[model samples]
Target: MKVSALGNEIAGPGGPGPGVRLVVVIEDEAIVLAGYQMLFESWGYVVIAAQSADEALGMLEAGSMPPGFILADFRLRDGQTGTEAIERVRQAFGPDIPGVVVTGDTTVTVDRLRLAASEGMPILHKPVNGRQLQELLTRSFKT
Candidate 1:
């Protein structure tokens, strides 16, 4: 699906501007992806959707426009996990692109959290509140 079809508002009068903030969301669940797209778009940010780690990686490989931030689901449909996907993205795009892993699983261990934290990546519990998502995005892009 076209990224704009997910309800994103292009930044410029006719299209998104060079300064527009872009956020890549890797989610296997259609509903969840739509929800995240809507939320980020409502905040005036452009959203890119990918259904799997491989798909997301392909975009990066093809030199797709870099996103200001990335939000990914912890458990993807494929065997690949969000952490693995984010690591790949970071390796390709560098550590400057901020990322957040969203998950419904509550059993994420402290060590995992520490690893993500060490990389300057944060974890957000699933069923993310729109307000919280917006706030996090704002902070992420501002840096």
Candidate 2:
């Protein structure tokens, strides 16, 4: 277990530990992934990082409960999009699990937009600030 800069104790694996929330983040880029992990942990969430949908599923199947929410990159390696990924996760968990897709690619394809809308998931543009993410989460989970 490690302590945050603010001195909150983080437990092993499924953590920020008791009473803290959980958020799973999918981003293929290593540096970007690390930044988000740190950011969410700092926000007092147990942040699970995954490079792809399969990896995230594997982690979930390995016995961790579904997260409170999900944040995924719009475009992942091998052409897999975040909308589909989020859909799969929601299917496994529950439709109530709020998900947000983040993308550096400004271009929003019609298909992607429709998919996101159909699932009731929001797509936030990349360079998504910490405050933006925090606000979105607060609005979604009311926590």
Candidate 3:
């Protein structure tokens, strides 16, 4: 799965790599969000950070820049699950937008996997590597 196939313009700040035009990251952990944002921005992807599902939804509803990819934490603040947030985003943005769930919860069951599969979304375990995140975003854009 090449990142280019996902409709991302491979133009980073330095005009290097496949430039991802926009990406939304929904995570409760500020530190984690900062890390992801920094990495993606360094690679030239326009990154949008949200501390909660509600904030992310607000951004989308406000017609803030559309994102080519979405990365969410399975657990969130205000008792909202990542799956719920993803559902809302999918409904609002349509299924063409790719989504990925990155979580520390290894207890995800078969039913959860099935649900994610049904939505054509992938779930990645936490402590995600930079390469893995890149790969997930690339694959998502392609799908």
Candidate 2 structure quality by residue, lDDT tens digits, 3-40: 32223343446534455577778888878887888888
Rank order by lDDT, top first?
A: 2, 1, 3
Index of the highest-TM-score prediction:
2
lDDT of 3 at 63: 41
Off by over 4 Å in 1: 1-16, 60-64
Clashes of each: 1, 0, 5
TM-score of each: 0.81, 0.82, 0.76
Q: Per-residue lDDT tens digits of candidate 1, residues 27-134?
A: 988888888887777888777678876666655444345668888888887477777778777777776888888889888888987887787778888678768878
For model 2, where is the 10-residue window of minimal lDDT?
A: 2-11
C-alpha positional error of residue 12 in candidate 2 after TM-score superposition, expressed in Å? 6.9
Q: After the best TM-score superposition of candidate 1, give how far the Cα of residue 59 lies from its true spot, in angstroms.
A: 3.4
The TM-score of candidate 2 is 0.82
User: lDDT for each of the candidates?
Assistant: 0.74, 0.76, 0.71
Candidate 3 runs further than 4 Å off = 1-20
Listed per candidate, the RMSD to the true structure in angstroms reads 3.8, 4.5, 7.9
